[model samples]
Target: MLEMKLTITAPDLSAAINNLAQTMSARVPGLQNGTSTCAEATNTTSVGADAVPAANPIQVTGVPTSAVPVAPAPTSVPVEQTAPVPTAAPAYTLEMIATAGTALIDAGKMKLLTDLIARYGISSITELDPSQYGAFATELRTLGAQI
Candidate 1:
């Protein structure tokens, strides 16, 4: 025979009793039914027909208790996606050289042009169309001058 004292505190008395029943059932094997309630046979043994049992019966008492309120489940939010940035193309162009030359001439860059023609080739410039120049226009011009 085993004697035990159990005190259960829960938000409600019924919940506490339910918890206590489960706990008692687990601790005392074969003493409780599937529902955690003591079997009629065990209850009868505690209070037999002839006389009261010798050992003090297991007592389960419940007291009203409080617990911190649980917060609600968090809401899921969708994120906005941004498009990828485009890569910039190379800066060198035939038009850039022609434009630079024209600007230099306007700003008294004749000496610069003469040096360029000497260093590169002037004949290359003759092959290029005045309306359209590419990245190698200056080199072509220098080459043309040399030829």
Candidate 2:
């Protein structure tokens, strides 16, 4: 029986080990470069029996486990559009008619009276009708007195 023990000192033991592994791989049959078969065998024993040996072990530094990033949920908001309101037309009132009548009488336009009579069928103040004028006779009488 023969027994031998060899010891080597290097500035970078990892680099020396890697170089030795590369050299041993090139020299030996069925050995990958820059990796220890013993280390791979130890890892295989540590894992489940169902696990298979990796074809490329030199590229692996360690087991990789990372947390997957999750994106925030998208926010949604509803938008509303408003339209402008339309203005109403000015109303024709009895007070407005009286004011206009006073102005007409002050202007001394009796032709306005004849035109009104022809249009509304009211000849005089006392005989003034209201049906055609739509409740404007009282305001017209007040305007006639002013004249």
- RMSD of every candidate to native, in Å, equals 18.7, 21.6
The global Cα lDDT (0 to 1) of model 1 is 0.48
List, residue by residue over 1-147, the lDDT tens digit for candidate 1.
454443333335455556776666566645534453221222223333445453323344332122223788999897888887768533445556656666656767577666664554454444444444443454434434210
After superposition, candidate 2 runs with Cα above 4 Å error? 1-88, 123-147
In candidate 2, the residue pairs with backbone N, CA or C atoms under 3 Å apart (3 or more residues apart, or in different chains) clash, namely none
Across 1-147, the per-residue lDDT of candidate 2 in tens digits comes to 333333333336456555655665576655444443322211221234444554323332221123223788998786776785758533445455555566676779667655765655555433444343434554455546331
Error of 2 at 113 (Å): 2.9
Error of 1 at 38 (Å): 32
Error of 1 at 43 (Å): 31
Model 2 score (lDDT): 0.48
TM-score, cand. 1: 0.26
